[model samples]
Target: MMTCLCDAFFDDVARATHEVLESLGIEVIVPESQTCCGQPAFNGGDWASARQVIRHTLNVFQGDCPIIVPSGSCAAMSFHGALLAHEKETDLPQVQAFGARTWEICDFLRNGLGIESWEGRLDARVAIHSSCHSRGTGTPEAIRTLVGSIAGVTLLDFTQPEQCCGFGGTFSVTFPHISGSMGRLKIDSVRATHPDLLVSGDMSCLMHLNGLAEKQGSPLPVKHAIQVLRDARVTPVTVQ
Candidate 1:
């Protein structure tokens, strides 16, 4: 099942995420019963609330099938929260099983399916923004390799590619000014290469960076890596 975070609701960054999966002949299902992975609660020192949310999530996503998440942050939350929030060893086994089956969307596509060639094409230059969780999970490398598979996309390089965009969930809210400043810096670094679009595994960083660009009256288009891979602009397949 695919875990589409609420963050994708606004601009629908993941509008074509499922379509891309299905295009590859993979079955995709997202349980409407699912909610937040409790990353916020866990990060804010509320283990009890986090544990409750995770238990509900586990119940909703019960299956041996892998739980695929679009956001690296949410993916990390479920994988780590399972172990961190559980107090008893009895609960540990179940949560651990859930974590073992969880796969970040990019990881699932690039590694899980062993996708070599892509029918979708793009002619734009792209830059990658690394999320903290994506870095920890080594998803950025896989993402780069996948982007390279595209026909006409040129992934650009600039200084400090691994730097955080400063949208550390609650950290951004509690420290808005600092967060905004860091975002500006991150965008500045991105703009240094003057790419046509920026892509990342997480929407939070994209939102933060894109919001800052808009505020500064700069035009930095941001996209989730999943959306780019979907390549919805590809010519439609004509049927007989």
Candidate 2:
């Protein structure tokens, strides 16, 4: 089972991930019954809606195969925080069990499945933004390890690499000015790295940073980490 805020983001990520896994001869079963992990509702402080989403998600993926999510925010919600929020609910036991089996996709690849190499090469210096939700879920190291596996790639350690890009979904809507300021700070850090590309696990954060960079005419391009790994066969074009 995998979950995200919307179907489009999830489908894109799932497509990329499925390509990678199939290339590596690892088969994955994507349950069509899965829905949003309810992080939006949870983050928005709507506990009841969050619980409802969680309950439906658990019911859908209760089998032996582990739940793998592409979004760190969604994974963290189901893996660590959601159970605590609905602890008093009668379905607490089921929620807790589901949480235990949830794994971020990178973590599942690098740790659970023991994937140590990729088939593509970008041959360029890159900087990685460790999304806050990914770090909170303890999967940032997994991302780094997976990125490191690509040949001809250098993962530079930029300043404030782990800072939030301030695109917390609805948080950006509620506090646009603050969000813009925070995004600018992240963009500055990425610029300082002089990377050919910027990569992160979360699409929302990447989209936010990419928009800011485009607005300022920054040369660096943004990509999801999975895209980087899956496209390792082709050299990335240098930004002018």
Whole-model lDDT per candidate: 0.76, 0.77
Candidate 1 per-residue lDDT over residues 167-236, each given as its tens digit = 8888999999999888888988889897877888888888778878888887578778877777633552
TM-score of 1: 0.91
Clashing residue pairs in candidate 1, if any? none
Residue 222 deviation, candidate 1, in Å? 0.7
Clashing pairs in model 2, backbone N/Cα/C closer than 3 A: 120-232, 120-233, 121-232
Sum up the clashes in candidate 2.
3
Off by over 4 Å in 2: 136-138, 217-220, 233-240
State each model's C-alpha RMSD to the native: 3.7, 2.3
lDDT of 1: 0.76
Superposed by TM-score, candidate 1 places the C-alpha of residue 23 at a distance from the truth, in angstroms, of 0.9
Candidate that would win on lDDT: 2
| TM-score of each predicted structure versus truth | 0.91, 0.90
